[model samples]
Target chain A: MLEFILARGNYWVIVALMMTGLYISFSAQNLIKRLVGLSVFQTSVFLFYITLGKVAGGTAPILIGEDLAGHHGAGHEEDAAHGTAAAGHEAPVETPAAPHVETEPVVEVDPETGEPIADPTAIDPAAELAPDAVDPGHSDIPPLQGEDASLMGEPLEDGVTETSDYVLSGHDGAADALHQAAESSLHSVYSNPLPHVLILTAIVVGVATLAVGLALIVRIREAYGTIEADEVRNIDIDVALEEEEAEDAAAEGAA
Target chain B: MNPDHHVILRVVAKTLIPLITLYAFYVQFHGDYSPGGGFQAGVIFAVGIILYALIFGVSSALRLIPPSFTRGLAAAGVLLYAGVGIWALFGGGNYLEYGALLDEPEGGHHGQHIGIILIELGVLFGVAGSMLTIFYAFAGRVAEISDEDW
Candidate 1:
């Protein structure tokens, strides 16, 4: 229970925000407060969309050149060959002054086993459960891939240092993942750009709708001399009562 | 004391508005590769103008961009979006079939590259103009920029 709950912390935060926004919109009597609630709800949706697009160790949807090693000369050549035109962005942040050594992505294939050379413990978890990723019986769950080809720990509460280890080994993992993809694509990802685009469009549309709602509120305030919903209701009731009384008086006079 | 003029606000707004506009354009153009795009850029642009209005008063802002112009801006944006689709049609494909927009048989997604930017432009105009138009309706009081004596 602890493993499941703590590992998936993001869902808890999203739920908290969603409930708060829902409560505010439903309970608020002030017109502005209700709008605020609506905005909060909209924000939750944005968060949800963004969360849906996030991959554990993925870059943005923008395709980097084929060389995950980011070997400056190598990536440049790859960019040219691929015709993707992404030039300056291929290297990691640490490599502004790094030497221009031309190197291919070096995944050491074992002389006998044909398995990739990597830390045994790092590969242990996924190696043990590798069949789960491919098995028909376990197909109901979305395939929880290792961050690379390894480090597929269940992310229980017991480990904090694993994250750092993963970071230190991330680039190696990327290259290895790409290399291994020729046989199997156990883990490699890019965040979905479709949702990114949708959110970009949605944010503007959200604001425009908010503005329309506020404009309506402004007009309401101008016409009714108050922005409170209950106050407006009172004014409406008073007008209806007066009209009814006037109609009754006119009927009596005709009789 | 000249309560009629907000010196600090005016100065601050004067300095910030230009930078905000510049950043908005940067975001607009860099949309494909970066985190920002047309919607965000449009909001930033609108925010710059809105900030100006809040500080210098709505009248000055209206003077800068008349309500008629803003209305036209909104309509023009919608038209631009449709216009791109029509242009694609002229290129001998269905609506918004961006691959047809360019004749480069060997060029990879050249049409998509241009089409996406143009659509982003349309979104920018549509969002910003509608935002300002709504603002004008509220702040200007019955769609009038300057209020006269009853």
Candidate 2:
């Protein structure tokens, strides 16, 4: 989308404005007009920076966490602990446990009689329990907590649950999280010293240039009782001719 | 002052000059995330003020920003920039290396921010002062030489 905008109209406008400003700055004899042109030219660069920093669906690089509103957080010690735990081992506790008993019953119920009727296809209980029986009284296994119940709310077919569903369902919350992440990344990248340093240098150079330019203008105005460049130039030519004539007369007098 | 010129152009120029300068500071402070910094924004802001001087005459603008003060400001800005780097150097780090100043070998990123801000402020001062100086020089010349310098 940003590419489209730049390509379609913004790019041309920026270029045109920059060129126009440069042309005015160079061609115009008036100092004020030249400054105006320089400003226009500078504005184009500003627009370029703004355009380059643009990111689609990206928010301002501000950390909005409760602890640091609009500040980026550095790496924490807890992150290292988590990393160690993840790298150390594949703990059995991490896997979802199989259900102890089957939820579906084999018996068919008659709708009219409201009675359970034994089906001929029902397997013997002993045979069914031989291979898949799970002990319910295992002391080592802790009872399931709220975490287990929450996981259970998901589809039962797959022993493992899809975390994506939970995140996807929370559209606004997920977007906020993503936005925060993007913002922090932007902060990290933009917070570097290089650009700031460059800008500082540019400003100093710009100031010095402006100062020198102003000094020149002052000298010009003093030389001719007018700030106008054309008037100054004419005065300079007249002065030069007067000096030349004086030198010629002096040489002739010496001869 | 010509009331008509003051009414139309001066008012707008006055409002824009400060507004742009304030915006430049905002950009410098928030540069860690935004598309602005001390230098670029500072130049724009200084240019804005120069525009004000151009449109409303230098005397009016000089009332707000005196020439003598701006020269000091320019030097002060350079001092600020060098101060940060020197502080870092004194802290046992290489020049311009901000991490040493904080005594946190690992907090280099944080130091960079501090250093950047210092340098940016320096740039802002230099640009604003110099730009104003330019305006002053030209305007002063116009004042002294032109029949209608006022």
lDDT of 2 by residue, A1-255 (tens): 332232224446778889999999988878767776886787676554443333222222222233122111122223333232111111111211112211121111111111111122222221222132321111011111234323223221222111111111111344544554355445432222223345545555555665676676666555565656566677789989999999999999999
Which residue pairs in candidate 2 have backbone atoms (N, alpha carbon, C) closer than 3 angstroms, thus clashing?
A63-A70
For model 2 chain B, where is the 10-residue window of minimal lDDT?
Answer: B141-150
Q: What is the lDDT of residue A237 in candidate 2?
A: 96
TM-score of each: 0.63, 0.45
Q: After superposition, how far is residue A2 of candidate 1 from its true place, in Å?
A: 3.8
DockQ score of candidate 1?
Answer: 0.13
**Which candidate's TM-score is highest?**
1
Model 1 interface CAPRI class: incorrect
Which stretches of candidate 2 lie above 4 Å from their native place?
A: A1-211, A214-218, A225-255, B2-21, B44-57, B140-142, B147-150
Mind giving the per-residue lDDT tens digits that candidate 1 earns over A1-255?
343343334556777788888888878878888888888888888877765554433333222333233221223333234332211212211111112422333311111111112223333332332233222111111222354322234332212222211221212344443343322213433344456668866886788778888888776776776768889899999999999999999999999
Report the lDDT tens digits of candidate 1 across residue range B1-150: 355578887787899999999999999999855667777787788888889888888998999998888888878888888888999888775687565577446334677778878887887887678878877877776532222321
After superposing candidate 1, which stretches have Cα over 4 Å from the reference? Answer: A57-190, A249-255, B1-9, B106-109, B142-150
